[model samples]
Target chain A: GAGVSQSPSNKVTEKGKDVELRCDPISGHTALYWYRQRLGQGLEFLIYFQGNSAPDKSGLPSDRFSAERTGESVSTLTIQRTQQEDSAVYLCASSLVTRDIQYFGAGTRLSVL
Target chain B: AQSVAQPEDQVNVAEGNPLTVKCTYSVSGNPYLFWYVQYPNRGLQFLLKYITGDNLVKGSYGFEAEFNKSQTSFHLKKPSALVSDSALYFCAVRDADSGTYKYIFGTGTRLKVLA
Candidate 1:
């Protein structure tokens, strides 16, 4: 695809259940980023992957949040023991290189009950 | 570390009026500034960026931003506001000389264009 792609667009899970969100970055892009947006809040940087280098995971809010990206293609964000505060629109973006123009996906809207 | 602040929570303007969304930044060395817009239920769409040279940078949808070095601010502006322009606006900044290569974003400002 010409743009970043993310799925499942909407996910609903129980408070203690775990959920995984997927992102397929633009082909040939070397940098990918994940962000979380709670309702009425700004985007909170979660994690970033640059090629094969160690991802910058400083933004991960908690130990339960983790992400992995293979090469520069597909990436997945896993949330363990989901809490109410964990519910948000999980957005994925990709850039040609780090700190370059980034294009964002439609985002996955996660709802924790 | 890099950070941005959007002072206004919301700005209301009538269609055809000029509009401005304020943004300020704190970073070391030279900074790269960017603006993005988000419609309801959608992800952010990049509008413009200021890397170097010109302080005034033009972007998509007839939007522009002025990067002020002394004030450490990059405010988005439009000559005329349209009903369709209503959306959430964000300002982001990254230190040009830093090795982290991270973009820090502001809380966001909601723009409401009235018809």
Candidate 2:
């Protein structure tokens, strides 16, 4: 892809519903990151992947939040039994390398009601 | 652990006037600092970064930031503010000691330029 792409630009579901957000990073990008941004808040780091391995999962808010990446090409974030607090914009970013600047996707706006 | 702080929630400036958005960080070792801007309904755009170089760093949109090692501060500046410059600004710091490649971000400062 030309840039980092996220699917389902907006999502609205009842509380406790499971939701999945997808990310397609730029081709050849070795590093991918996931973040959450609540209304009027800062970027919250969720996870990071170097190839298919996730070196950091410290930012996951709870056990219900999990993510996976395959061969550095695509990644998915899943939220099980979502709550209203889970409402936020899920952002994905890809970088040429770990230390390089990143390109971000428009993000998936998830609204848990 | 790496952390960033943006003390102000909002900054208002008049057109053509100088503007500054303050940021500070805390890290165990060397800090890789960065500035980013976000327009309404748009994703963040990288502005500039402080990797191992001079204290002063210049970036897009005529913006510049000064890295003060002693104070652990990276303050963004612009000599002449424009209405178009109004946006949400974020400060981030990469953890120098970790392989997680994680960046700790500040809460963001909304810059409003009055015409």
Best by DockQ: 2
Write one digit per residue (lDDT tens) for candidate 2, span B13-98. Answer: 99999999999999998898999999987889999999887999999999999999999999999999999999999999986666
What TM-score, to 2 decimals, does candidate 2 have? 0.97
Off by over 4 Å in 1: none
TM-score of chain A of each: 0.96, 0.95
Put down candidate 1 lDDT per residue, B50-90, tens digits, no spaces.
99898999999999999988899999999999999999999
lDDT of each: 0.92, 0.92
For candidate 2, list the clashing residue pairs, or say none.
Answer: none
What are the RMSDs of all candidates, in order? 1.2, 1.1
Give the CA lDDT, 0 to 100, for residue A100 in model 1: 82
**What digit string (tens of lDDT, one per residue) describes model 1 on residues A9-95?**
999999999999999999999999999988888988999998889999999999999999989899999999999999899999999
> Backbone clashes per model, in order?
0, 0
